[model samples]
Target: MAAPRWDLGPAREPLGLIRALQGFFSVFAFATLGGFQGSVSFHLSCAGSPNISVSAPFAYPFRLNLATFTPSLTALCNRTWARDVHLVGDFSSSAQFFVVVAVFSFLYSLGALLLYLGYLHLYRGAGGKLPLGDFLATAAFSFLWLVASSAWAKALTDVKASVAAPLPYCHPPAVICSRDTTTPMGTLNVSVVFGFLNLILWLGSSWFVFKETNFHTPPAPSTPSTM
Candidate 1:
């Protein structure tokens, strides 16, 4: 009679909860450059217009000023950890959305790594040591936190401005993912990429913890008698 053994885990982080709420959040589909987050294609946009530059699967007819743009965006995914791979700039409106997504993506990516590591650590406990991936991961997190803080501040300001406008309560510049903005969302995409990366990192960490704590271990083999 151990108190009926009815227990629930603590509530998860708000960010994680929000991320889970979004049914279709995935870096793979987004990174592949051939998908849509609702009406907006996840493709990078022309540097300063509402037009798109590159389409998914990376073919020709759908390609544009590669010399100027393509390299910059794809560079973020160099398959190596130490290099600065993200393409920076809020070129076009669509590009701008990618920027937002990119910042978020960056955060999510790191979150994935951390969460995954956390899973290993929890599973093995003392045996599962997370091989000190401190440098790059730490840097990514620090940078993400700084950028996120800045973004939140700016977003708050934007909210104030929007509310002051002869419009609805706490209105955020409608169609913010567009070029027509009094406040330019230039690095907006960059920050967002980082944010997404953080989200992924956090998720992976959480998963690691779950597998470690909740996974059922098989019964141990019985020892032979030493008569």
Candidate 2:
């Protein structure tokens, strides 16, 4: 008969804790997503041209590696960002995918923070609790992030291993191009760490919701006596 109303009930202890942690994660997510410097770098060198280097912050998804052309091979390499050092791990699609995952992670974590704050300030007085919809959304996003982060770590490791050999393109005939990447483990480690943390947070929040739902239900109204 009535549209489902927003939940407004006393907050559970665990829910409060979960919201606090969500806020913390949002801040760290911002740092790890774009603020932190990426360790991976690219170095490209061609015959007669001096070596060029491009370093990027953590490839949360992917970073474009660009090298400048020297005066010697201005005609060949050119002085633009188009010349990519083609290597196993120079600019892989998997790297870009990882960045995508990280972006979504940042957005969702930030959303969690806003939702928590909004509920606390605007809804708490009206007995508002974290709605099932919000909880479900968090659960879904967290699960996907967990999987994406795991895959990103694995993919990065594979790319690192595959790029061990030198390329023929980096020679006299074509163009001498090489890739020298910095530590790939930093991004992987951060992804895995937050991935697991988010998973646990979602699970804990779910369990708390479940407990509250079952234990604090309102009693059904009694039937009226017959005249």
Best by the lDDT measure = 2
TM-score of 1: 0.24
lDDT of 2 by residue, 1-227 (tens): 32334333322356656755754664454356444344444466644567666443434343333322222233344443334333333434554444555456556555654544444444233232444445566667667656655675676566555434443334453355656765545644665576567667766766654443313554456899999
lDDT of 2: 0.50
lDDT of 1 by residue, 67-165 (tens): 122233334222222332222222233333433544564455445443433443342343323222422343444454445435543543443243223
Q: What is the lDDT of candidate 1?
A: 0.34
What TM-score does prediction 2 earn? 0.55
